[model samples]
Target: MKLQQQKYRLKLCQPAILPLAVLTALTASPILADETDAEKEKARVIEVIEVTATRQTENLQRVPIAVTALSGAELEQYQIQNLGQLEALVPNLNLHVGDAANAVVYIRGVGQLDSISFNDPGVGIYLDDVYLGRVQGAFLDVVDPQQIEVLRGPQGTLYGRNTIGGAVKFTSARPSETTEGYVSVLAGNYQQRGVKASLTGPLIDEQLAGRFAIAKSSRDGFSFNQYTGKNDYDKDSLTWRGSLLFTPVSEFTAYLVLDGSNQNPDYSRTPHRETPIYSLPSGDFLPVGEDPFVVNANFNDREELRTKGVALTLDYQLQQSTLKSITAYREMNYRTHLDLDGTPDASFGIYSYEDQDQLSQELQWLYRSESLSLVSGLFYFRENSWSLGGAIAPDFFVPLGNGVFFPFPVISAGLRDQTNTSYAVYSNMSWQLSEPLSITLGARWTSEKKQVSNSGEEFFGTGIDTPQGMQAVFGTGIGHSLTGYDASQRWNDFSPRAVLNYQYSSQTMLYSSVSKGFKSGGFNGRLTSFAQPYDPETLWSYEAGAKSLLLNQQLRLNTAFFYNDYKNFQLSRFSIDPDTGAFLSLFENSGKATTYGAELELQALLTDSLTLNMNLGYLNGGYDKLIGDFEQEVSDERELVNAPRWNGRLGLDYWFDLGSRGTLSVNAGASFKSKTYLTVSSSDLLAQPGFTLYDLYVNWQSQDERWQLNLFGKNLTDKRYRQHGFDLSASPGVQLGYYGDPRTYGLQLTYRYF
Candidate 1:
């Protein structure tokens, strides 16, 4: 059956070769027909992108940092809907869905795997300049965005702590004076359906303007569950945003934004890949299959996620400076249930729930002069979060002689509460030293405090179905209520950055920089006993890069090389408690490591109607030392987690004019990644082999620009690959792997109202 499916996919791809060949031929010939010098010059000019990566508005090519900026139009053209879709467009970035509630993100081989409230994300996600405190809510939907900027390497100096990896900023579209709006509808395979709409207009003439956008989408599951006769890994979500811009006077403005999302989807399906023999009470062992999208589970798994946030931004423009203030509040509630064993025997299962809220305030002052630019800010953030849930193994059994067995059901419950607060002050200054040379200096001092309380109980005996049932068999049960522990810790650090930039020519720039990054330490939230707190992790990075525009602005090329000296790398591990014989998750600091890499990005307008773009990345280096209990198991020979040795993307887009009727566009792209390890131990069961994916899109628009249509196909070849994995063979006797989405084709239609 799998072979037949492969053959069918090959038949579907044969039609794409002709169009690709035509595009290639066009790239080698002149695209403009008998045009004057002025017309040709206008056709070759690339759009000038503006970015705020350095805390001030400036041309993207002039920034002394490694950054990738994508405009709203470009995002739409690429069909990017969320943060997970951005990995293919950027170099050295990796993102995937770890579970229903966690979106794992990695940049330049640095990120956090655990999503518990006590642990902070290594990569910072910012929405409209407001930082998201938890990784559980970082998988944001892109709704009416104005721009998205991905800054590579460490951003500790300006973004503050927990940014040792990098930072991603999503800037939403603000209210506009002109009245305009659009509505779009889409349909695809697997019962996929979606609708999106947006509107922007003035409420009080030139004084007040309001904008609103909403998106709702639903799709059938990707995997089939034989036990329940239902589909798994489905999608159902609704997201919306509203904003009001008040310009009381010409010099002052206040913007208030509100956003929310609700996602209720079927549980993620992690099918068994390789399984060890586990005899059931019936004297038979469960059999595992090769199919990745089929599961046999006894539990009806599900997940629910709801989030809301509000932010107010105030800006006051002075003669030579601007003062700004941002106040924001956000909250999230997430719950999920899983059948970890992926078998009908119901050997092991788990449920988790988390509730979190955060409040933040920031003030900034910007000063710009003829030869000098300065930006300074004060930031304060606080968060309160808690989690309550447990695991169950009601059908667990231990065998005796002569085919006899005894029920050994295991039930466990736990609760953890935590509070975090942070304060920081930062400043960045840039001065032009000569006609083509400039220097920049920045620094930030941050202090953070974390407090946590944990309590739990585990029972091992017969007739232990739930936590309440434990009391009935208290005397007979072999378990005890764990002693609760409360702890607090404080840490402070100073991160600094220095850069030198030289404008070699009007369209070329060269830069070199040195920066330091830091991530705070905290107690493990999933502990059965009191343990020492892990120490903080720090890194020093040195980088050099160049940005250039060639062929009279028709081509843009950027390249960078970086080396990092890492210390006290925080690593997560699972081990069995010697006292209680219970499995526990904990963190320990590894000794030292180093990483060096290089990246290249190119965008060229081969002709007036043809464009080509590519991005390539190469990474090397691993741990130089090891420590702790798992040292013998985890060796330095393993590659870094989510860090592929080589990754790249290539794309081509061409436009065709249809006289006065309409215009059509076609785009083709392919992305490839080398092998990657998903776990710190680099287990072979959790490693993803190298793979390549292809995509194609066709678009048409009416000459009046009021109607548009798009037909798109993703993963065109129906390639099979793993997005995430877990090695639970030691406990559950099953290796679980989550597969990526298969081939999907859809059509979208849009109508504009003005």
Candidate 2:
């Protein structure tokens, strides 16, 4: 590690305010830039931010949509490492991590809370222009990114299906014509250490360029298991990306991107601190633990995830339009061993392993002229996935004779294979009817086919604790054999949109739109009997919004109000089967639901030295009607999972000249989230109380902008909060919660080489 070489010179107890003293001393020198240029730059707070929200590059202020754009510099200044922290900066956005491979995302009270292989997220995630087919490995770390864009609302017209909520787009920094890159090192508490380096430059003069970047980070866990004498949430990960840009002709360009990551970590969750409300099946009471970050598991739990992807993009510039093609392939392998009950005596556990592969191709033509602009595209996607898992009982429960214990799984074991193929054709057009007004129309036609194959066995018999019991469950011996199932289904849909935009002036615009979105239906292979495919989910969204820059470009404010009518909403739940009195995974279609919300974003240069940014979101979400399989109506007043009534952030950024030596910048933010439930089947055990988190950072840059030193603290108040929660009442009194990180402070040193 590079830090080892420099460790001797650094003191361990340096004051947190030492950076400020250094900045004060440097301020005695002359200013780096002229006064006029500085004044002009400070006044233009709007800063011509750009985005591809409309499938075309345009200024954010000029785009008639609800969008937020963040630059790489901005993300670094805020010390955001992954998508999970992004919720603090964007309204109505929630990101939860179940493991290194699975990221559950929600936008505007709409999202997929479950990480089931058969289901898809309502919000689409894209890298560059390639859509990610699965949530696995979606919570990728930031790596030399150029920009991140979030479009709030149904983007189905341009992005296709599964975008009823919204979309997130990430664009990486490209290789420059000249040699340029940076190297950074960070050290923090909990044995935290990380290294990130990137190199980009011309490989063949004006025709070709290449870029390569790599990042490695590791951190010790905070949660400790006394019985096992091991930490439960340790992390170790490495990620690398390489890209090449080829320009063989004056009007044509091709780019190839390859990226991969490997992660190994301990268990992701520990037992909840709240006492169990139900009695244990063993007639034992829940253990008492005053510390929130402690558990009593005795099993050996491990997790490993590997992901790789390749993408090729080509663009051709014609006389009147630009044609683009994208081809992508991705694969992931995820494996985990989990202790479900968290007690020293593990009543339940699981070993789950899954392998997935996906491929996609898309071609589009974009044309823009004086009075008309249009985008038309064709997209195709295919995916193959397989899962093998086993549910097991504790070794102590079924001990063998002669100091031995059963080695095989106890309850159930299964293997499942799934495949999906989808195709779509979409077009969006805008026509200028008047000097300051335009009407936009868009539609998408999609067809999809899905297939599922499942085979599994259940061990049942008195004294069935050995390999013979497994054979009996498979019917190879004396027990009843579980029947295997194979099924396929096809679906088609047409989603459409209409928008009206009025350009009040160059600095302001108003827009209103109505759009439709859809998600494909699939089979739930986990079920053992009479498994049926769920119906597709659909939603129609109506929204009105405004974007404006006021006070001589010193203040920017954007707001939007939206309402969605949803039908056949897909929901996943763990429910008790009346006949068996056992919990089972169930996928169902809710009859109807509705969500209405409003969002406000503001960016203002309160003074030349101080800036303010704020985001506020208010959501009202509930079911119009729903009936569970229990022959009873689920209450209509239940709020959506992960949907808080109120969520917002307030940020302050200040920068001052460190004179000729450098510049100093300081930023602080406070984020608040109201109480939220983690699952649609809201339970007292699944609810997360509202909490507030604060972050602070200070950066000092060298005069030439080649060196930067950053001091940062996250969750400064050391608030303990839950990122996710699960109700295992089926096991009688078991509740598990995945916790957010604790107060962490770190310093980073970065040097640019060009």
Candidate 3:
């Protein structure tokens, strides 16, 4: 097996800042751009520096940390609605859909890929300062983001759970003691449509204020089902956010935020690879009219996810220390059609499946000063899930003992109802020992347990068994297997992190840290005959980096190099079974992997009006050591699926004032990903070539900062590719999958009043 090599790319673009002539002409641009003379001076320094990278809000360049921040305006301008969008634009980070709202986010060569929610995320995703509890509902259809802060390296010290790789914080806009509102609309190809609205105003003068936002989008899916008739499939989604602000005293304030999202895709199941492709080299603009293979007709997979939460924060200022408390409650539900892949066949009989899930969580914390800071929190997560599956009668002459085959897909609908509970307590402290150095230390103890049950039919790959089949096979047992078994597994982790920082000067700092990460193990699906589950896996990272401002502030560079040692890496294994031409898969902890990577971010302000931003990420990753029990049907050494060794981005923006009436700005961004494996069996050769995507946006605002309009186009090059795919062995030669979308263009408008 060959290992993956290091790869990365960097491009140069014009600055995103405005030209001197334009800036000079815009002394009074759009209302939004026409900030107070004093306000303009402060913003000119850092473009609304973010606070998520570190625990405090300060000059971005002054923070001795590596981070990337996208403001609410930036997100709107770029149309970064989901994690997938972030992955395309950010370096090193990768997010792939796992069925529905379940997006697997891998960072710096570490992350979770399996469908089981029991596993922990190497990277943590946070909304409104609250940690998201599950992978299934983590990537909500989102909008109106205030700021998105991407902090590289281990953040286990403060963020606590599932922060082994790094952390992503999404801040939502809050209500102010004022009045404001906006509206946006988008229309495009494939019947794509989107609408968003936001309103915020005083309920009782300065004492109370409320803010609300709602967004909805739908588009006809690109895939076509031969059996479902012409023009099949389209995706639909909805997102909402609301906030309340109450501040009776100038020194004391309280913030409450409520947010949620829903997703329902017309086509949940992957199209069988044997199926047709849309717009091949022929540029037909439509998928082939007929199924190329006989097994492509049963395309039935469905999924729905709902996440709702409320977070409350209170802050108080005292003589010596400023105190803060954040409390939150959240509930998430996920349900999906059992067959993400096409059904076995009509002859296989009643091919059907479904899973229902519920998840809930809570967190709280407090912190003091930067020199002596303390943060502690309590977290509780619980989930209840159930799955039922059944399949049609099997086809005869499929090489079984009897010429008459029984319903093959399922002898009975597999049924499993499970309950899981996890709780953790964690704390962290950062201390400054002297003018030149500081240290941060933190740890968390987490415990989890689960219960599962199966009533009725067996698993598909459990080895077919029939009276005649068993007799023919020397009684190894008929395809029939039964179980009323209840299993429980529990474990605890003392996750820890420490970092030491040395300040060489006001503009630069060097830092090092050691951190650990883990993913819990749980039940595997029973699509076949019986059930299988694996053990938990763990990883430790040793890292060091430098944050600096060079070229007299013309350049801001931050880079980190890391060595990750993985133990029992959880991965899906596949092998061709004798009964079926297809490959079978079950999650297992196997092999040790060593990975090294570095991230480079450069922000340059060549002139007061022109600025350039570029980021590069390269990873030298492969399974350095591996030991496991598996059939010879698969290869051992290969690149991990969906992990691109290199990813990069370059962006440029130029701002201007149009004739003193409003502001005009233009920005362009491009992203590139090196070649990567789309499937586990890298040897079989189903991969995506390196692809680059480009985007551009132009905006104009009203004389009043209150009204603004934005025009955007994504994937200007119209790149075609697939992000992820999977195969199953129960049904011979049965492999189906999905791919990414094409270019999209739209316009949005907003109006603010205060």
lDDT of each residue in 296-366, candidate 1, tens digit only: 77654768889999999999999989999999999999877777777776577676778999999999899
Query: What lDDT is reached at residue 627 by model 1?
Result: 65
**TM-score per model over all chains:** 0.91, 0.92, 0.82
Native-vs-model 1 lDDT? Answer: 0.77
Superposition TM-score, candidate 3 onto the true structure: 0.82
Clashes of 2: 1
Ranking by TM-score: 2, 1, 3
lDDT-superior candidate, 1 or 3: 1
The residue pairs in collision within model 1 are none
Q: Compute the lDDT of residue 99 as modeled in candidate 1.
A: 55
- The ten-residue window of minimal lDDT in model 3 covers 1-10
Model 3: how far residue 456 lies from native, Å: 4.9
Q: Which ten residues in a row have the lowest lDDT in candidate 1?
A: 1-10
What range of 10 consecutive residues in model 2 has the weakest lDDT sum? 1-10
